[model samples]
Target: MPSTIRRRVPNALLDGSRPTAPSHIDGSATRRMAIVLVTLLGLTHSNPAVAQIEGFTEPHATIDLAATENGVVASILVKEGETVSKGQLLATLDTDVLETTLEVARAQMHSTGKIDAAQADWRSWQSKLDKLRELRTKGHASQTELERAEADCAIAKARLEMAREDQAISALDYKRIEAQLERRRIRSPIDGIVLKVFKDAGEAILPTSPNVLTLVELDPLRARFSVPTPQAASLRPGSSVLVRFPETGRQAIGAVEFVSPVTDAKSGTVPVAVVLPNEHGKYRSGVRCVLEVPPPAGAGGSTSENSANRATAPQKTDGPPGPNRKDNHV
Candidate 1:
């Protein structure tokens, strides 16, 4: 302190210009910052706290009912919006010709006069052949007469067999006609409500015709969600999920029915379906809904984490809810 030591200062420092940092030091600091940013990004994506997912409600099944055979519609038993049960007759095609054919086949099948006559003829010929054999053994009948009797018996037996075969064929024809008549009558394949009727009575149905009706099952409504891959991983079939319909201001608990194993590569999402009870027909399908997804295992304080991340996590929609799409139903 007593003696002042002179120290050399750089020109840049003396001129109020700070010295530049070393290239190595700058590089090291940049690398450390890059690593920290990478780590933070990874943590955010790997353990994301997803609370609610947006989805839509849809029917469990949609069916387009059509006739298997081409014919004119004779009668329509159900109206639009009518509830129907499985195997209930919904409509009938023109069956006048088929009915007549079925009656003719039935009469033919039941007719036993030809068979009875053939059996009588066979018995008479067989008896005659036996008598002829005895007469031939006693040298009372000619060999030609015995041979003719045997041939007649064989012919009669063949005729009887032919009559029986004809009877069997007639029975088969009757059954075939009955099946044709049944096909003309349309029946419901499932217990559901008829959404629409495309055909009317006396309308012609051809191979290229439109469907007869549109049916849907709504008892167990299906709610579908496109969830983030991370959230989907924690979901399993039969897990309870809370579903809220924003339009109706109603909420209900549903059971998870399906979770797709494959992920949508473009959206990084997985498909999930839940079954919501709608036995009373209270909830209509095609409504927007929200689904609550629980956090993955080992996620500490998931409640607070989900709350904190709720605003940052935006709900994703793969597309417009897929309502009324038959292939989209669970």
Candidate 2:
């Protein structure tokens, strides 16, 4: 038979008293753990993570329309907020004087009287010279006479050339006046809408006058953003981005049009521009927006794989380790 062995219980246990509490080191460690967990929870609740960057929308182009020449405004063709096509007539200056001048120039350019008269004169001189040559050859005219006739013919030829030059100058002057007349008619240089009309009919336009009107292109609006340098590195021309308008709750996919190569020293950011198509004139510019950046390559695959592994993993129990379990001694 095996010998019977006996173990003595503590005095506190025999008296029904609780054992001494855990050491201060263990208690302090537990408090520290609780503090860390509370801090993490508070941070998570107070500040939510933001995945998008803020930006603003602006027109692709804004033009101040003005006349190249000075005159009085005769007519305003388009009013404010009117859509205009490229090369459409917008306004006109006083053209009464210019029109009359252009008409006179046209007549001068079309007339051939001077040219015909010069030709006739040249022919008459040539005929006389021919006769003089013939007379000299037959010994019927003196050498001096022949020489004098030759000089006269040359003078007539010079006059004819001068007349031709005068006619050409008149033609050029005609074209110049016609161009001046056309300049008086202001035309749209771009497909856009007139935002303002600064001049009205009968208003005098001087060389230093302000713009006659303001035009802005609404189609293909531009979105501008200031992004951190680290994030800007991933952007390039033609890259796609998700843009959102918070005010209207509208979203669009825009293509990156520009990315500044140099970082801003003061802001520690880089300027970025994206293009959003508004072909139907549905979108207005100067609105606030947000830009969503895409994750790096292969990040989505890794995250999905991790989630699947977690789902298939075995669950752990909170109880003590079993007899077969091996504890790791750190």
Candidate 3:
């Protein structure tokens, strides 16, 4: 039978160069066994699933629809989980005041009669001057009186021109006021679902306070998460991604939309993102889940992982190359 020496305690010297050799095992022989044991432990942790790589699942981003101006929130036009379109009305500020101001501006424009009658008076004065000059030069009127009439006609023409210009300026001012008033009716900037309505009707929503609503893209929803540095480097935008939420029973397939260029030292990770199509408005933000991102091609020198349906770890994702990358799976 082969001799078995299982657990031998270290002797006087740590390198196993004992002051005296053990009666059964030599000092050199004891050290070699210890080295072999340590090697086995090291190999276990080096496996891909055991350590050295991982990715996390999280929301891509949360967009707050803030109040741009202060006013009583007239109404929340969208309910929770309601799908909305870009530029669709999402909330309304009590624009009663803004509307009133706009009306005043309109009224002011209407009251300015300067432009309405200005050209008519100028033509009338020109006709009178023509008749007067013809008669005066024919010796029908005094030279001093003709000069006075000419000067009067010129002044009238100048006053009419000045009045018309002022009226044009007022009209422009009223149009600007109307545009400002339109701002009070809040609108959505993206085609997304209304995640929340922060205010109810008759609530005083302020510009500095939290916004009146929260929205996130729906058709092309984003799923965000983080990954360790080593794993992140292998990921590139536009790689295929698979997502699942067992609790919600939501499984979405998309592509890697974004990967942060740098890692965050504090978190010891880099952000990754994916964009999933949610035309039915069934998925939502803030849900815990798993995002399976496919590894990039040619990364790790094009290993056999591409053909393997079951990977040792999460699949790597290719990030989108486009500049408007709204779909990263971070």
Candidate 4:
């Protein structure tokens, strides 16, 4: 008769190398033990579920709208939390001095009297030259008198050119002054919600100071996140992502817009960004979010089969091989 005995499992058994079977064990018990060991090994090799990545939502754009020209704020046309469209007037600087300068320039540019005077002088000189030539032809005027008259005509022509140059200079000054005046009035550069009004009426604003207003764009919001290197390698732009805002329980569909080519050496991860529609001002920027990305296709399947199929696949021809032979019969 056989007697039962127990012995300590050797480290070699745990290390996956086959161990010698106990001499007294029956075939049935040994098979059962082997089955249990295989199940444990299978569990160790299986992959874990990918964790959700953390992300943050941000405005499509943020602008600290500043004054292009420095002066006392004349008027504040918008308040914080106000929705404004692109090119909408937001604030104005003191334009009293600038407007006066612009008016002076305009007066100079519109002063046609100088140009008109130049033209009249040119015509008068041309007539006098003609008369001088005619007199010389008739032998009524001396050559010296004719030559002096011609010299006078040439001087008038030069004076006329000088006057025309003055007019052009005045016109350019007018445009420059008008542009300076326009810069005194600040306008929104994008369609967005005014986050803050830094300066109010009667306050001085400088180009070097903090911006006059803070603006944020809400439409087409952006979400920024990072993923593990292995997963990021398989991701492509335009891939769909599911986003969840844990704090608000809000959800939105997003599409991958950017994937960083380089991985972070320290963290062993890669950065990515997605764009989501935020029409109707529903989503707010600067909110924390969670992202769920789908796993790649054939994730656990054979790579060799996929590669073979791709290598042996028939390539598309540029045109139909000769026309259909059936058509030739027709």
Candidate 5:
């Protein structure tokens, strides 16, 4: 048997003057609090860091092309802003004289009548020499007669050799004239856009004349920038970076191609270069751009030092200087 269990109830519960909060209400509050805490913790760890660096876009190559031969400009095949391929004729000098000379040389080189005549003469002499040798062996010809025949045969052979030599020289002269003509025809040495045409048709061009045209190579454009020594140290050839052109609103991925070994003592920075592909001529150079590179892992430094790095970082604002080393240009 159980003894009578009695519990005292609150006056409010008995009269139900006001409803108390339910047990489930407390459970709901605890769950909502847990969700809020988890969200706050995630927000703290989910933020990503970004590093901004300054840079500029430049042409892969800039060449001032000059004529190799001196003559009057007969024609200009390309105009400013026109794209051209390597070895494409851009202009031509007067090559009438060279052409005429080449024709004459070709006529001489191909002329075989003289050579045939020489061959006939040589065969005749050889036959005569052989006959003379046979007659001398049979005691029908004197030694002096055989010697005279041999001399004549040798002279004929020399004449034939001279004819061949003349033909070879004529062929060589024709090639020389052709090479000279080619030099007079100014051609683009690289695939690029003509920035300016310095000479036009009917103008005179000289071997020592100033550049005939200014060409800029666009493919594989270069982005040159400077970064703090520490940041630059982490950059290696083949490293990729994001390049953003502020003027054109274009963005591209570029790869590091150069890291200068020398550092600027005053700025404590090093020069760096990245090559960006523009095979389709989609990108133009000489524009201000920014490079976005994430900080290296485990990179920790003073705040002021980092700020200085950002402040003193080199930004490309002008056209890049001409390439110095052979490998520097694309």
Candidate 6:
């Protein structure tokens, strides 16, 4: 059975603890002391823990974008390890030949414009012939003169149609040549630190085999790691991933933007690519990392949790941590 007790004490002493004064210290002293202790206890219990994951300091990646339409490398604007921003012009190919081709095409297009005007003139002549024929039928013009006018109009009309076709062909050629010239300027595919320069100035670059001068798109990049097949089943593309960059003292979240259809037979691991934003530009393409590609968590845990408790269980982080590997995925 439960029991309760109550007693009274002096009004002034009531607010103090330790059985204060004259045996008349009021019971209010005990009450105030109890309230103070409870406030302290609540404050202590309200603090939340900050969670951190162990991961590699630097993200690793490789330099490997192939050449664009090429010619002799005219100039190399950057060296290996130089930083480049997205669309920064890193190298110039000797696009002189392409430039000449484009100029020639433009000239041809201009010539076609003249031919186009001549064709329009021929159509005008044809209209005059039709008017003459109508006038002859009304006896307002001679047959001989009307016949000659018709013949001249037919010839002009034929020449005009031929000129128009030529003009159209020339316009198309000009655009195609212009596109080739534009492709000669090689720009960085992504804002990345230049890790390698495969081409030097004056190197003979070929359209069939391009000479890539600068390789980039590294910073704040893709981290490629593999997950066990069973663990991978729930990971869909574009799913959010928790990312940690230890080197930069950065921690953030990203999305699972890629996963391999092919699985490794020996390791049973499937490749996954995650796109994590690197605003600070601190990550590299090939650095290995330990990625906590998040949940649906505990994906490979015991099957017993699969049925009931797994759906609602809170994360139990006490499990042993895994190795930190550099992610070199480009």
Q: At residue 32, give the lDDT of candidate 2.
A: 36
User: What C-alpha lDDT values do all the predictions have?
Assistant: 0.70, 0.66, 0.57, 0.65, 0.66, 0.54
Model 6 C-alpha lDDT per residue in residues 175-276, reported as the tens digit of each score? 988777667777777766777677778888776657575354544466666666655665678654445444543434455667899888876777777766
lDDT-based ranking: 1, 5, 2, 4, 3, 6
Residue-wise C-alpha lDDT for candidate 4, range 1-330, written one tens digit per residue: 111112222233345454344444445534433333322222212212323577788987899888876689889998899999999999888888778888888888778887788788878988988998998999988899888888888888888888889879999998888888888878899999999888878887765684798999887788888777766766678754545576865555456789999988877778888876666666678877766543344453343433232111011101101222111110
Write one digit per residue (lDDT tens) for candidate 5, span 146-219: 99999999999999999999999999999999899988888888989999989888888765675788999988
Best by lDDT: 1
Summed backbone clashes in each candidate are: 0, 0, 27, 0, 0, 25
lDDT of 3 by residue, 1-330 (tens): 111112211121234332322334335433432232222222222222312222334334457988767778887777998878888988877777667777877777777577557767777777877887898889897787777777877877898888877767778988987777677778888777688887898989765675888887655567677766655665678655445555664444456788999888787777777776554445655555565432333433223332321112111121222332223211
TM-score of each: 0.74, 0.73, 0.63, 0.72, 0.74, 0.56
Give lDDT tens digits, candidate 2, residues 42-127.
22222222135688889888999888888889999999999999999999988898788888888887888887888888889889
Give candidate 5 misplaced runs (Cα > 4 Å). Answer: 1-50, 300-330
Better of 1 and 4 by lDDT: 1
lDDT of each residue in 1-330, candidate 1, tens digit only: 011112122232235443332333334433433332223222333344435688888999999989989989999999998989999999988999988898999999999999999999999999999999999999999999999999999999999999999999999999999999898888898888999999999899988984888899887789988887877888889765656676765655567899999998888888899987675566788987877665565663443443343111111101112232211111
Which regions of candidate 1 fall more than 4 Å away from where they truly are?
A: 1-50, 301-330
Q: How many clashing pairs does model 5 include?
A: 0
Write down the lDDT that model 6 would get: 0.54
lDDT over C-alpha atoms for residue 289 of model 6: 50
- When sorted by TM-score, best at the front, the candidate numbers are 5, 1, 2, 4, 3, 6
Every model: Cα RMSD to truth: 20.4, 23.6, 17.8, 19.2, 20.5, 17.1
Q: Which stretches of candidate 4 lie over 4 Å from their true place?
A: 1-51, 207-210, 300-330
Q: After superposing candidate 2, which stretches have Cα over 4 Å from the reference?
A: 1-50, 295-330
